[model samples]
Target: MKRLAPHSPATLACTMLLALASQTTPAAARDADKPRPVVDFTSCAKPAWPKADLAARHSGTVTLSFNIDSQGKADAGTVVKSSGHAGLDEAARSGIAKCRFKNGPGAVQMQYVWVTE
Candidate 1:
């Protein structure tokens, strides 16, 4: 049996970005029992892996928290969870900021995983 190094390329696994269950603020007149709408990222471009991070083989998942404006634009994206790497975290934050959701005026949180090829 052979062992692979932790930082080795063979040990790296890329995970697709996943949008977890969302939470929304209820409108003043809206019912509390109604389900919140899902965020639609139809116009979002995928985040690019930071060149330096990739060179150093940094990998982790970044969780971003943000609010979507009425125009469907994500505003004030903050890193609720760090990926243990600044580059990866910033990449996720900037990428998500450009996203436009179909249903907006609410809060959203999503995760982006970074792995070396």
Candidate 2:
């Protein structure tokens, strides 16, 4: 099987999404009343693509719901929206749990998108 390049579209898209998520725009700052993302992506580690899912070309977005402790640690997440594949959903959930969030002591719902290019 051919492996994806380090800079593949999927990888690039994930990086872009993380970058966008970490930025606080003037508009966002102005709209401080609005809710913020559950966790911070600025220093979050990227989730690895499951080898089986990658080999099978499985892709979709998984929405997760979970709680963040006061210290920014996340609990094991519940899958609010499945990626149509168990492996993908589990990988996303596990990866998200490992992230260090900026906000804490609250419930959060977030999504992780998986795609093939």
Candidate 3:
């Protein structure tokens, strides 16, 4: 039988955190347990993209972090992680910035994807 090498402290810590995070209730579910965000993606306008160019030129995920204010409005958040393309990231940011949420409490994190062939 083969044995794997031991994980470093950092790696172990990251694994533990990931496990804990996964076990925790999702943001949406937590919100549902309380008052749901008034401006959830379902209610907000879907972000639009340049389909033709996107399909031909770019493909990746745009991880955006935006605050859903008490009013349910989506305040402009940071791009913590991004897809490779600047244009795609910018587009996602712009789309999210335009969205508004109904009255609610706390902020929410959102991620958008832009894929190409």
- Report RMSD for candidate 2: 7.0
Off-target runs (Cα >4 Å) in candidate 3 are: 1-39, 50-56
Q: Name the TM-score of candidate 3.
A: 0.57
- lDDT of all predictions, in order shown? 0.74, 0.70, 0.54
Using TM-score as the measure, the top candidate is 1
Q: Return the clash pairs for model 1, or none.
A: none
Please give the lDDT score for candidate 2.
0.70
Candidate 3 global CA lDDT score: 0.54
Please provide, for model 2 over 11-45, each residue's C-alpha lDDT reduced to its tens digit, 9 standing for 90 to 100: 43432132213224576567567554466666567
Per-candidate count of clashing residue pairs (backbone under 3 Å): 0, 0, 1
Write candidate 1's Cα lDDT for 1-117 as tens digits: 687775576866555576754654456236355434355557777787777887678888888888777788888689988999999999889987887776556677888888665
TM-scores, all candidates, are 0.74, 0.69, 0.57
Q: What order do you get sorting by lDDT, best first?
A: 1, 2, 3
Candidate with the greatest lDDT versus the true structure: 1
